[model samples]
Target: MPEQYDAIICGGSFGGLAAAQQIGGRVLIIDRLEIGDGETSASAVPIACLEKMDMTHVIDQVHEEIYLHTRRRTQKLTFFRFCTFNYRQFCEDLFARTGAEFVRARITSARAGRVETTAGTFEAPIVIDSAGWRTAAGKGGEKAARASRKSFGVEARQPYRGEGLHFYVGPSRGSRRFYWAFPAGDHVRAGLATYTGASDLSGDLERFCDDLHLGPPGKVHGGYFTSRLTDAVRDGMFLVGDSAGMCLPVSGEGIRPALVFGQVAGRLAERVRTGEMRLDQALSAYRAFVQSRGKGYRILDRLQSVLNVLPDPLFALFARYIATPRMLRYANRGYWNVASPDLLTADKAADPLPATAVPA
Candidate 1:
């Protein structure tokens, strides 16, 4: 007989870890990587989120402003506070807090109450697919669910000191491509991304580094992130993070949404475990919660579509428009709030995981 658990969570990264933090009973988390072994994201997020997770110790640098660069002009906006963190450290620390059993194994498939892995099979009433963009554990096969609507991003870290996050756009780098440099302590993560599903970005990334006059690229890491939204609940299993296409459209921001939705899903699952609600009720609630952000996702998706085809001169004008006080406020209150209304609030903190429910 397969080992049984109160819940079986696939993928032990941001989404899985966040969900594990909230759940109670004998929770089992499965992933191919030992905790913190892989670092795929650029590792930047709003500072408030770090505080709420109580993982601020891993923050590498804090950025209070963002600079947008175009061939014709440059614009600086300081309406938000963001930070770059040590991804490995962040994951390891967060995992230590969960108090859940973890298995380093490749997940083969997961259905309503059964999760099959290379190691063995595990049984649970609740199963969450937080694996990733190419995860095979969802309702439809990974190919069907993620057929198109995927964006590729790659970045390399190099020794350079910089302040604030910077974004460059113009004919110099292909209008359809977006380039960014995020400062993390003494190093900067610089790279280029194609809105289209182009996977080869090493040459582009090298050119970007040269244009910025940064040092030789060091370690590089990146992968595809879904550019479109998908169902939150698939085949009776809850999906979060890239598995559910929670990465934002224009900015490719996944951490915030993953953390937010993971928490929500975990809490609802706990309600089911404790009989506060039924499994179907939890599924409906999660689906509704994800759909509530539909308008915001669509708006960003449209903006991404426009940016992909917008001319350099018009893009410059749009950049200028974004720098205006009114637009900056809109970005802070409207654009940012779409994922989580309280994300931008300075004083907002995530609810602490219930001690009485979590295993010791």
Candidate 2:
């Protein structure tokens, strides 16, 4: 007899844990490292999307705004700008509370029904992949076509106000991308992001440091960032979070999309196990669901394109206009509804913040 579980989740990071917590079953969670050393290792958030999902235990702090900037535009983003996380602690707590078995084993190979790990072999009727930045099951080749220009970023907490998130746009040395500085408690998270094959960023870092008011020779790090989705759901296996390629392409924001998809994936995984849906249906459903929530991301991409076409100063002026407090508030409420499933109804009114008008 094949040793079985209701579900075997091949990851224990935020999205994996979230899926495990939402479902009912004996879940076996597996990962290469005992700790969350993937991108989840160091995540900065002004978490506005998952507020209604009841994962409050994982949140570390919430900020007031997401300050927006570009090479040419500076705006105060008053919506969805709350950074709250203790990635490692949050992952541990999810498993501990949910009573899911976490196996510290690297997944050597994964097929329709079998998962080979460092420890032993495991088989389950249903498998969900929450692995970040990888596809062990061999369904991700289509991702190459949807790839974004590779970019890099580094985040560190600096001594600063613990209230609002700030950003620096368009001062990097080489090709003009954006740098970010979100308030991480007392310290600030300052990092730069750019397309991978575009240009070398070493020269850009020097200019970025001066532009962002960070005087430094050795105080930062950078790496690739992109939100590429793949043909994820396959066979008895379902993919959620980064493994499913749910990161935001423009901003490279992964947490909100990951959590949203986690909820969706968990529900679908349960359905597939109980015979309510087939794998193709579930994958199609998830794809449609993500496309719905992806409106803002799509819009941002278009806006970025327009911004890129204009001269840098002109683009900055546009950003300055959009960053007014009122606009940020509208953006926050709009994106909040977008990220949360329960809040999207027509009758529901999003929260209103105090209005600050944009200059004409």
- Write model 1 residue lDDT over 244-332, tens digit each, in one string: 88899988988988887888788889888888889999999888878877778889989988888888898898888888888878877
Which pairs clash in model 1? Answer: none
Q: Give the number of colliding residue pairs in candidate 2.
A: 19
Candidate 1 Cα outliers beyond 4 Å, as residue runs:
138-140, 172-175, 341-360
Candidate 1: deviation at residue 16, Å? 0.7
Report the lDDT of model 1 for residue 164.
Answer: 96
By lDDT, who's the top model here? Answer: 1
lDDT of 2: 0.60
Superposition-based RMSD of candidate 2 using all C-alpha atoms, in angstroms: 6.6
